[model samples]
Target: MAKVQFNDVSFSYGDKKIIQNLSLEVNDGEIMGVIGPSGCGKTTLIRLLCGFIKPETGSIFIGETCVFDAKKRINIPPERRNIGVVFQDYAVWPHLTVLENVKYPLKKKRMDKKQMQEIAMNALKQVQMETYANHLPSQLSGGQQQRVAIARALVSSKELIVLDEPITNLDLKLRQEMLKEIREIQKTIGTTIVYISHDQEASLELCDRLAIMDQQGNIRQLGNDYDIVMKPKDRYIFEFVGISNFVDVVAKEDGVYINAQNGLVKLDDKSVLENPTKAYQLAFRPMDAVFDNESPIKGKVVTETFLGNITNYFIQLGDKQIRLQQSALDVMKYGKAKEGQEVGLKFVRKFYYEKEEA
Candidate 1:
């Protein structure tokens, strides 16, 4: 499989720039997921790689082949690039049967019927839809149709597959199933798949590496799921990823000054206060919030959700809602802490984000 690289890639519509001089590499055989808010240029990035829109002032390369280099004014046609793309809508032709849809790629080449069927059947079975070869796209369910689309893409033996929001339209169960199948197929083929999505859960489960594209069209951070979730680079990331707990505190030279009911209790973590925006919000997962018996700071448990092995509790800690997720076995109680109970609150490992802009 070939590695995809964007060298100082920039794209614009007339005067306004959608993507700046952003550059990154999708390692060979790695499923690099592109995630960000809507209109953050995720789709635009795909178009550039697919050779739909040539970079305005940079180059895009597929394993050393400069497909688009604005300096040289090179523009390769989309069809000639030989990149496989599976869009969100499951683009299967309604007029064709499942076998015809999967075998369409081989039709262009002079492959014999047996060879074509071999490729199509192997791909179909890989997606677990070989029995539906005679079925039309309309007859199959949405998930099944998407599998057909995947099979069609695989039948060509293309190394790089660009999937743009491939699972957004499916129901919950099917979405999960299709995600599993897609990951398996990618692993089985060892193809470099660029899976694009706005959802974090999907990206966390599928991608080996993730690039978070933010507004103003910049790749803010790129790393593993742990970096994206636990150590967000900024406040925009804390909100984008749906993190549960947030504490707005000011940095006093000594420590973080969080306003408590009795007074502003300073929880010392001097190392994290080194940044210029030291007056930051600590964004932690609900699971990170702890209930300590000896702690002086307290919060009333506003609500509780008993989820078998773990329980989720939302505590009213001063003016903010500090959601806590803990293992059911760790706690002795199941019911909500009585109103105004003042359950002791302790800050566990907190996620530090640049303070929110007023």
Candidate 2:
């Protein structure tokens, strides 16, 4: 496996700069995901790394080879970069059979049938689509077709594989299954993978590390799932990761505190308050807002959803609404909650941030 590094890379169409001064590395044998909102340059970053687009400034290195370096006038073509890319479209040949599609890249290397078939079949069996090897891509379902595309991308002995929203079009169940398969395959192949997606849930679950970008082409935060979730670099990342419990916290000389709606007192660690607030948005996951039947921080049970394993509570707290995630067993113990039933709430966890400046 080879490490892929971007050093202060920047690119744009004409005058519109899509990526600027961006630099990051995908370590060998690790899966790193690039996640952001639509039009936040996720795809552009991938293209740049794949050598589809050259950086207008700085360099991109695959292992020690400088694929793109403006200063040195070094630029390598995509086909010569030794990186396999599976784009959003699957990019499979409609007229080609599954096995043929997988064999396409190997043919460029002049590999024989036995050699090519062995690689293709192994890839197909990994995706559980080996039986459909002789069928064309059009004859397979979307998920199966994608598996073929994945197999084709892997047919070559490349050190890095970059996938752009590999499971975007699949249904929920298949999406979940594909994520597992992709992560497993990356491990089995021992190839570094850079996956790009806008889905935070998917990115968090599948990636070893992740980079969250913003509209201005800034790489906002880059780290493992836990670090990003527990200590987000900013409000954009905090909210994007789906931990939406923002309380109006004020830092005083003593401790950080928030008087949530209905007199719910939220106290932060004194250590966080010792320094002036670095962030304006004090956030926490909805799951952290623990509920009890015997506390003073009271709120009405506005709604509840039974989701088999986990029952979600939609509580109305003064002027603000908050969500609580609890087990179905807890819901069974509490009985069916009536709308407007006064319930006790307390802040069990919190993350503080300084206010955003417009």
Candidate 3:
């Protein structure tokens, strides 16, 4: 296993900077998930780490070895970096059988034929593809192909593995299964892994820690799944990661007060507000609020969607449209609320941030 570190790493393509003095670390054997919107430099970071592209500045280290150091002009080739990568497309050769594909990476190791075959078989067994050793890529399913690709990556002495949207091509069931398998294999082998994806749900499920990158090519937040979800650092991170309702508020010594057109709500945490009389943004998740008949904050329901276990309502109050999600059981208990019905909203919890001035 290896620990990867990036110190002031920066990269750019032509005139556009993709990564701006980014610095982070992934500990040995830890699975770190890198998540961001498209064009947020997640893929570029992967490329820079794997030696596919050299960074314009800074250094990258794997364990004690300096793989890429701009100051020293040290640039190690991808094969010598002792890292394995699984791409979104699987990237297995159609002409090679499963066993051959797995053994291909080991061909340069000067091992005997039997030793190479044994190592390849063991790798395939780790991915549960040993029985299909002779099958060609054309004959295997997408999931099966992905397994072979993983087996190929693990067949060598790689200390770190980079998975770039590895499960994106699979169905929902297969994706979930693959996630379990990946986690299990990583634990068993104790290989440090970097998982990059645009899917937040998958990242939340599979990562030991998450690194959220913003559109400005910088790390926005780095923490556990719950910390990132429940306590985002700012408005941009909160809105990018999950659903939130924003209301304008006035700051005060005792609390931050929300002055909605139809009602008022006060936040108990005085520290959230920097000063009195300044406008703040009150952000809360859909699950944090409820519909109260007597609430002073009112809205007209524009649409109601029944999403299996939960129901979502898009309500319009003044110039803003707010979303609220409630359990189906709650809807049943309260009776289904109809569209066009004006309903009151009560805040159960909220997050406070200083409003960005336009």
> Best TM-score goes to which candidate?
1
Q: On TM-score, who's better, 1 or 3?
A: 1
Per-residue C-alpha lDDT of model 2 across residues 1-358, encoded as one tens digit per residue: 7898999999998999899999998898999999888888988888888778788899999888889999999989888888777788656898889888888888878878898789889978987889998998878878777777777777665588888875356777777787898888887888888888767988899999999999988899999999898888877888888958765665666656555556635453554543564544457786677666665667778888878887677877656677887765556554456667788765666766666675
lDDT of residue 123 for candidate 3 = 93
Candidate 2 or 1, higher TM-score = 1
Poorest lDDT segment (10 consecutive residues) of candidate 1: 332-341
Each model's total of backbone clashes: 1, 6, 0
Sort by TM-score, best first.
1, 2, 3
Q: Candidate 3 versus the native: TM-score?
A: 0.88
Residue-wise lDDT of candidate 3 within 62-96, one digit each (tens)?
Answer: 99999999999999998888777887654588999
For candidate 1, list the clashing residue pairs, or say none: 286-325
lDDT for residue 184 in candidate 2, whole number 0-100: 86
Better of 2 and 3 by TM-score: 2
Tell me the deviation in Å of residue 209 in model 2: 0.9
TM-score of each: 0.92, 0.89, 0.88
Whole-structure CA lDDT of model 3: 0.84
List candidate 1 segments past 4 Å from native.
Answer: 275-279, 332-340
